[model samples]
Target: MAKHTTLKRGQLLKYIGKRWKNLNIISGNSFMKFLGYDGNGFADVWVEYQGRLLFLSIKEVELAV
Candidate 1:
């Protein structure tokens, strides 16, 4: 199998699942370290593709648990 590294923003993709809902991506995790967030928290969503990698909001995810 080969890997594809050509993902664009706002592109509707799907994941291989039968009992889980997908979230939207407010901002990408490629560079969250540079973009600091406030205490109030901002909108965060998960960006994934089938069996590929999944990227979500580290802030909201941590707070959720």
Candidate 2:
């Protein structure tokens, strides 16, 4: 079973530089490094897929703890 939670700016900041499961459809179930906010309502993450590093801007996705 999977659990979900929404995090505010302060709470999310703590996870920076840590790995978390990205629930966004584009990178579903892939663990990505939290890079920090872009000051434009998007979360920046480093996703490794197919031997490539992808920089993605995500909005509606749950980060599992």
lDDT measured at residue 17 in model 1 versus the true structure, 0 to 100: 24
User: Could you tell me how far off, in angstroms, the CA of residue 6 lies in candidate 2 after the best superposition?
Assistant: 7.8
Which tens-of-lDDT digit does each residue in 1-65 have in candidate 1?
Answer: 01222333444433222233553334442221212222334333344333334544433333110
Clashes of 2: 0
TM-score of 1: 0.24
Off by over 4 Å in 2: 1-29, 43-53
Model 1, residue 47: C-alpha shift (Å): 1.2
Candidate 1 backbone collisions, by pair: none
Q: Mind giving the per-residue lDDT tens digits that candidate 2 earns over 1-65? A: 11122334322211223354752323343444444444554444444444445465454333646
Span of ten consecutive residues with least summed lDDT in model 2: 9-18
Residue pairs of candidate 2 with colliding backbone atoms: none
* TM-scores, each model vs. reference: 0.24, 0.30
